[model samples]
Target: MNSQVFQTPIEYLKGVGTARAEVLKKDLGIFKYEDLLRHFPFKYIDRTRFYKIRDINPELPHVQVVARLTHKEILGEKHTKRLIVHAQDDTGVMELAWFQGIKWAEKNLVIGKAYIIFGKPGMFNGKAQMAHPEIEPYSPEALKGKGNVSLQPGYNSTEKLKTFSLDSKGLQKLVAILLDQFAREISEILPQYLLQKLNLMSRVDAYRNIHFPENATLLYEAQRRLKFEELFLIQLRLLKSKLLRTQKFKGNIFGSVGQCFNTFYHDKIPFPLTNAQKRVLKEIRLDTQRGVQMNRLLQGDVGSGKTVVALMSMLLAIDNGFQTCIMAPTEILANQHFISIKQLLGDDFVEVALLTGSVKKKDRKIIHENLENGKLKILIGTHALIEDAVQFQNLGFVVIDEQHRFGVEQRAKLWRKNTIPPHVLVMTATPIPRTLAMTLYGDLDVSVIDELPAGRKPIETLHFYESQRLQMFGLIKREITLGRQVYVVYPLIQESEKLDLKNLMDGYETMSREFPLPQYRLSVVHGKIPAADKAFEMQRFVKGDTQIMVATTVIEVGVNVPNASVMIIENAERFGLSQLHQLRGRVGRGAEQSYCILMSGGKLSREGRIRLDTMVRTNNGFEISEIDLQLRGPGNIEGTQQSGVLDLKLADLATDQEILLQARKIVEDIFARDPQLALPEHQVLHYAFASKNAGLSWDKIS
Candidate 1:
């Protein structure tokens, strides 16, 4: 039978009896031959050299000793079994202690026998001691190619697994058994030309070497091949999805939004549309009027005037007598959008309504009645917008603000609200790098508002060590005296009180005491506070009722107090660059000049220094995001909360951005020449795609 068909315990393999198999399954997750083959080592131990006993230091954590077992002694009562052995190397004498299985340990260590012991050396009663160390009997086979061993496989196991008898060596033996027996010469998935061009190893070679490499160079090569396979498959999936979309989904083509723009520009609007706003609106207009359904991502830095563009797009749907829904992630943001849209389109007497989870039952009933009857042209709400009870009259378009926070399934569900899937426009203040935008959103067209509105003053940023606390406080006070509000933000960690690490509670009390004045109203807000109380405090700050507000990173996203001009971030080093930039954005939204004071701790690491320096140098979110991607990598951005993303195992989304582009090019070229991958030469590529797309067999699903 083919080895692959042995989908049972490793112990069932030819030489592995039930006893060893029990140990294999317990110590390792290897239930099958394939599982054993893929169980790669965590790290390796080098036991090449042996030191003289006299040269040994008790304080040293680990040491290699070549010695002769001088004698063995049993100590302690029956309840506490213990065995002590004495050994001598060229340099000095060392003691070996064993807690349990004393008799077995004593039998292993024979008197006047030379052997090698690898273990941690420690002080015991002012003498050197090695406790239950790894002892291997002296033999040419055991020390073969002395000091040449690379990485040793460390199989994952639990205490129960260990007791059941499975260990790393047992797992390794089973893996070797599988490799020698069932391992097949699978067809290469990648084309020969592409493999040579990319200098990649074949699938079988990569799978083998990734689990059990001959050396470091082979290991690196294997890893590179695996990473490439993962990324290539991801690109293929996206392209396939895009193909399906274009082939199956038909778009709703509306008349040019150009006419409504002219009307708003000439007669209906109060203020002149910002040049940046006009540019983005034109892009949206072009996208909507195209034959294809518009799936566009609208990205802008904070305060870059994206809201106006979103409003204008909705106007296009409204003018065409179709309905539009703007979905925000939270009620506060939804309410904010409702207020802004109401002001922007009021001249046309367009009926706009806000629907949130907390809307009164009576009010919701009225809103639902108006919504189904086509009386409401635009409905702005949070997740409540997608409720089954609320049906749109036409639902021609969907606008998702701060779209990254929502999942793909959630977005898809919202799109399904319309009979013919609505044209989608996703808006975000977080500026993602363009390369990431292409790979992650290849199905969607992307338009960026790169420029801020004219006449907006640049926010000035400064960095300070803890020593400059007094001076930082003075700057905040000065800003407050100038009729601008000050925001003091604290850091959140696991838990700490003595160090006082500038938590929100500490900052709130300090502000209340240090800056206590009848005129200075200090409002406090933090994550621990109830949503209602937090919103109340935030509103107070927005309305200028509170001159200084102390908050946590909870203010990173939605608190819009344009009147606040000074942002003081305590323990700024603890915060990420993109986040600090977002906090800085809260200020400088209005006419007043804004200042951001970054109060870091005593010393900063190289990364911390770079983050602070970057903040001080520029307020560009895109640049900061680029730096963040470089420093922290993708998993930081693709948390579990951000679902349906391509959670690539091997691809470094930032550094390998160029690779993504190359993969896309290759996919397009290959498909254009051989769309079905039916060419004999392309069959390998087809199999490779299938193997990877079938859900990576090697990857553990967490």
Candidate 2:
């Protein structure tokens, strides 16, 4: 490409001036000629087939017609006035109306003259009508010049941009001007061999057809080429990061499976490891032993025994004469992990300590001393572990639970603790879809423990309407009588006029009335409650002192009570699929058959029904995640929306998996043949990669 021509500011364009350039930049992020060139249309409309007046229907998305205007009039008073025009074909007549721009339409439209009209067809008062339709003077020469193309590109514009005459049509006109002037300046970025092997279109032709195609076949080819390049560049950058990290950063060599790991595996383990768990462990072992810094993401569903795998990985570090730490997002989670790890060690001799903001000043001093003196082999805590005062003697491995909750800079702090950054294993209970895993954590290796431990049964999920409240209450009572606890979760802390869902306080009051205090004890927790009070309530529930625990989603993570056999989510339709799944996982921890009762009103939206049906259908987290990705696009998924890496203009992770996989495979093959891109044919590829990644620093990290 001619860099100077492409990088020219938008104001320099023939039609766009300073005022319009500011609006374009602010509304659409179009600053330079290149930015406008890459802005592909969202959809296309067929304009080749002109519809007759009698054939127009509301079911049709849009229609184009060339007809003669015979009648024109203005109706109603100010604020209610509208321009009404009648256009007639040989078969019938249709009404053309405009309310906002009536003056412009009344002056510009010529009666008794032919016009080409295009817009969405609708019906008003049992007659065919079009509101604010596009009108152009009919000319045979203009039609011939357009070549009668079937597809017309439609761009997206904001209301602010529309005020500056930058609507879809305006944007399309600007794109056409740029293409006509600088189409020859656009250069190909892909190599000739790869293009021929893939049968891809040229870069310049793709850009032209993407904005203004002569035919549908050419449009399809243009889309294919552009989507491939977008995904290929992303995959190339990620894979290159992984390659460079492996070659540049040397890791601590854990040469042997020493006594600590062996002892825990043989004796201290409470249950046998599942095949999935073993597989993940093997991957981690290989990564650490290869003498390269390990950055792996461990994805497992709730109660899938990921904690055990994390602990065992830490033990491997201990056997290599190094210290390790586990960081959690919340204090409650950190405390729970500390307790679980302690219980799992049983009679083992590995030293472990808990550190958090709640730890006293004197106690923190002792923990600090032990950490620096190398007495603390393992430390489990919240963000306190990343403090500069909490230095380590020789930290070799680190485990981060719920890794998405922490920012990139926070994780980098742990990396700086050691002269040579420790091997990092970031864990998440929220299962990520395959495509998302490739894009979000592409720089890190991924291992999944896809199976639950033995003796655990899948939770039986049930949906209930408000009319069936009594039946749900009866079931809860039966479970409590059977020596099992219950969890009652509400969506909100207090009542809101906008939403008709039950709140936590109201539900707690009703529960207190339904089951008297002397007969039944209930603990309540929500975000508004004090930290100490929340912990007290949680402790009471954990100890089985309370027969029911009514809380908010704050208990969604970190709380594990085996005896809690029933989970009742009030207004279940208000929660997301992933959140509902996490709440369902709170139960079914014990050998007994557990139940998750989804309580909602009688009416449900389409999306709400799908979410509930999916919960009742399967217990597979991976399957649920895929469905979630389909329902809500990649931008709406939990952690990825803020990453800024998913700002893709053409390729979609939800429906373009095939293209993504092919792009990844092609990128891998290219790297295998030419790691440095030093081949004569790969010069274009190297320059493109370098230009795309200019001034980026994240590639140096995980």
Taken over the whole model, the C-alpha lDDT of each candidate is 0.75, 0.90
Which window of 10 residues has the lowest lDDT sum in candidate 1?
693-702
Tens digits of per-residue lDDT, candidate 1, 1-702, equal: 232354555667876778756666665556665555556666555445556766677666567776789888888788876888998876678899999767778776778888778788887777789888777666556556432233445566566655644566555655666666555633355688989999999877886676567667787898788767667777676676676686677777778555655576677665666767777788877766775677888989998878878877887877777788899988778878887777766655677889998899999999999988888878899888878888877788889988877877778887787777888899888778766676667667778888877768999999988888889878878888888999888886234856547767767877888788796899888777788898899889888888998888788776677788999999898888878888898899888789999998877889989999999999889998889888987657533235344566456778777777787788888877876667878765544443433232322211
TM-scores, each model vs. reference: 0.82, 0.95
The CA lDDT at 481 in model 2 is: 89
Give residue 438's error in model 2 in angstroms.
Answer: 0.8
lDDT of 2 by residue, 129-229 (tens): 99999888888864753833357889999999899888998999999999899988877778999899999999889988888887789999999998888
Pairs in clash, predicted candidate 1: 3-182, 23-166, 41-153, 44-152, 52-91, 53-91, 53-92, 54-91, 54-92, 189-684
| Most accurate candidate by TM-score | 2
Tell me model 2's lDDT, rounded to 2 decimals. Answer: 0.90
Return the number of clashes found in candidate 1.
10
